[model samples]
Target: MRPSRGLLLFLLANLLLIGLLLHSVFTLLTLLFEDCSNDAIPAIDIPAPDALEEINKLPQYIPKIIHQTWANESIPEKWQKAQKSCRDLHEDYEYMLWTNEKARNFIAKEYDWFLETYDNYPYPIMRADAIRYFILNHYGGIYIDLDDGCERRLDPLLSYHAWLRKTTPSGISNDAMGSVPNHPFFKSVLDSLQKYNRNWQIPYVTVMYNTGPLFLSVIWKEYLPTVKSEETRVRILMPAEYNDHPWSFFGVYKGSSWHRNDAKTIFWMGQHWLLVTVVVFAFCASLYVCGFYAYRRVHLRDSNYSAHASPFSSWSWPWSKNGYKPIKHEV
Candidate 1:
């Protein structure tokens, strides 16, 4: 019967533990809710290299603009080719480079409300990430990272009102996004930026969650639930459509230039995530078992004491008021 009480207490404690875990998962796991990869959204289908004429026939919804950002006009020698690649291909497209000065002034001018928060970001990458969304939302066009080069014409991508490339596992990325000016999704992104802006302490996490792809992805995931029709839906570019294949819209080059030392740890975890998840759950389960049994043992021991009187409590000592006196013949 005493053991039964321990088991009951164990279950009750576990119920609270389970609730907390579920709550954590619901909150931090928002990014996993949507897998925009594959057939989850309208496909950005492009014609083959030989079918150039057909690609031109596609309607252009986004404007003829390509936006990139950096600290200044001096593009790095390593990425110069990539930068030139997009330019050489899209000669007809107007290009705008938002250097640090231009970006800050633009924010101060157009989005004065966000000026304080924008300037207060702990990392330059945060500002870089934030400005791309603002610029895309305001100017309306394709926002490509300087490291990403154009593989072919981007005419097909403009057909969608808004679009993002699907990252691994879940959610969309901010790199190489396309949108018409004032798309609802980017509005969600711009509006949510101020709220998501917080110092995560670690350089990488701060940049990612505050203004990087992870931030954009989370916003897109949260914003997707309210979609009513295709017009407002944000299209996704799958791997094949993005850069994996030869004809993919863009080519990936050396990037993540802002990565700090912690980035290696993060990347390692990502590379071995399944093992990490299993080990974490295993440790938690082991801890739960140990705690449950430890509690049960202590509870049962206390219960046993309650069931009977203590030997010391029953003893009678002659010198104490509670003790019985020796009998006359007791010698």
Candidate 2:
């Protein structure tokens, strides 16, 4: 049996919704989970706790410069200890604290071309997020957040041409990064800073998708596919070698001082993402159903109009006001 018109309409509406949902999911996965399977810095290559001493004496690829940033010269009481931990652990390494004035001055002096973009960032945190990339590209060194303290010597990480720490679920974090000066990956990141620079309106989202970790992750994902040689490849620093293990290089402390109220909503949604997804799907389905019914109502109302009173009603013989009549003479 043939399906009714209403049934066909329902099927079509559902098909459209399904296609839309699939497209959204594909785009999200493409951005958030790209390159998760490979490119991770393997454990075997990392210097174990027992080998930290031997590795420190060996020559390293990255410069012995540790970069950290803040609003001014005076570090806050809360993060001062964490900041000191890195210095105490790496006594021989040079430490550069990028204050607000210093950062803007450096940008203006060395990279005047980016001064406009650097100045126009909607959030101060965006500037902080951006300068780290530029600093890494200009000078080969490890950039770590003030909140992240060094637990072990970072000489092991210096061996990689360029490296970024991986975060939970998917994607990489910019909290800690190391690279040789002018590495292709860092150069790509430098080139991409302005392109990804757009005000998303929301404080948290604008910072993240524009100049924060998400931006870095997206650039890393895109940059990997174009890399033809091992030297140009950006290595992934997995959690185990980062902060998950006792032998991990760094320890995380409380951070996110720049987060606004919107960040809480975002964090809540992340915690209850499955429920949010289900509700969103349900709402879309409900809209489709309601729209289909409204269409059906309009169609039926038009078709069931009074034929005798309406001049533009369906074509019919004069004798048949109801839109049909028998032809007696020609039978």
Candidate 3:
């Protein structure tokens, strides 16, 4: 039996109503999450002041020795070179903090802003997920990146009240960062990351939230007092390479080192091996190409024998050795 026109019309009206209701619900949901995304700071369980103090005593902080890999690099030769570089940096800094339980917990609690997963692979985003622990766990000072080997003493950075360097056109590089316990910058930075993360779904706010130095500068400007003498020593380093030079941790792409992996681990291990491997491979290939060209040139030039020489003249060539020497016997 066919349904009545009224029944069909009623069903259509209900469907339209349902659609409208769902749209309204979705709009409300988006609005609700908007605040969370825009907010810069995430709620964290702060460690007691005494516990934080205890953590500060664990070891002397080294500006180098950011992090290490338990497994060798994918390429052995490259791994060795990177390890040597890390070691050299370690010598300069005296010590790199080892991965320990306290450190892990601190990172999990403090910097677990992103809620990203390593999925069994080490990455910077994972570190971003737990940056707080890294800062709190290590003593003396935090080492920022592994690949960035220090060429000069960071005494200038340490000699000031607080120091931050700007990179390229971007301001305030986070590649090498340092802070004492409970530094306001730390709180402000974390807060900014959390706020941006919270409002991440809002397109405009998401962009703002994901930005590192923007967040940093904003926080520093808002909170930290600027004094002429030793209060804030922020400087931007002129970039040697204009291409792919990132000024802040926020400049990293979604899957890029800053965005995807932890700051400390990526700085320490991810980059050196890749750069070394590429350099070594290029060097080896260049040698082979040059050697092959030289060998071909020498071999061809030394091939003084002419294969197409006439039979009558084969024996009479003046430069001919035994193989092609002209026969003195008259035929």
Best by lDDT: 2
Candidate-wise lDDT, in order: 0.80, 0.82, 0.40
- Candidate 2: pairs in clash: none
Candidate 1's error at 172, in angstroms?
Answer: 2.6
lDDT tens readout by residue for model 3, 1-331: 3533443565576567657865744432332222221212111221222354633443432243244322223424423453455456346554443343444455566555433431221433333433432462333354444334333233333322334444422233454555554544555555555444443443333332344443444454445354243333332222321113321121221222234233444344324645754786587667655754464344334443445423333232245464333323333
lDDT per residue, candidate 1, 6-49, as tens digits?
46766888989888897855634666555664334344366775
The TM-score values for the models, in the order shown, are: 0.82, 0.79, 0.39
List where candidate 1 sits over 4 angstroms from the true fold: 1-14, 27-44, 297-331
- 4: Cα error in model 1, Å: 9.9
RMSD to native for every prediction?
8.7, 7.6, 26.4
Give the local distance difference test score of model 2. Answer: 0.82
Off by over 4 Å in 3: 1-83, 89-94, 97-103, 108-126, 129-142, 199-208, 224-331
Residue 217 in candidate 3, Cα distance off native in Å: 3.4
260-288: candidate 2 lDDT, tens digit per residue: 89999988876776788789879987987
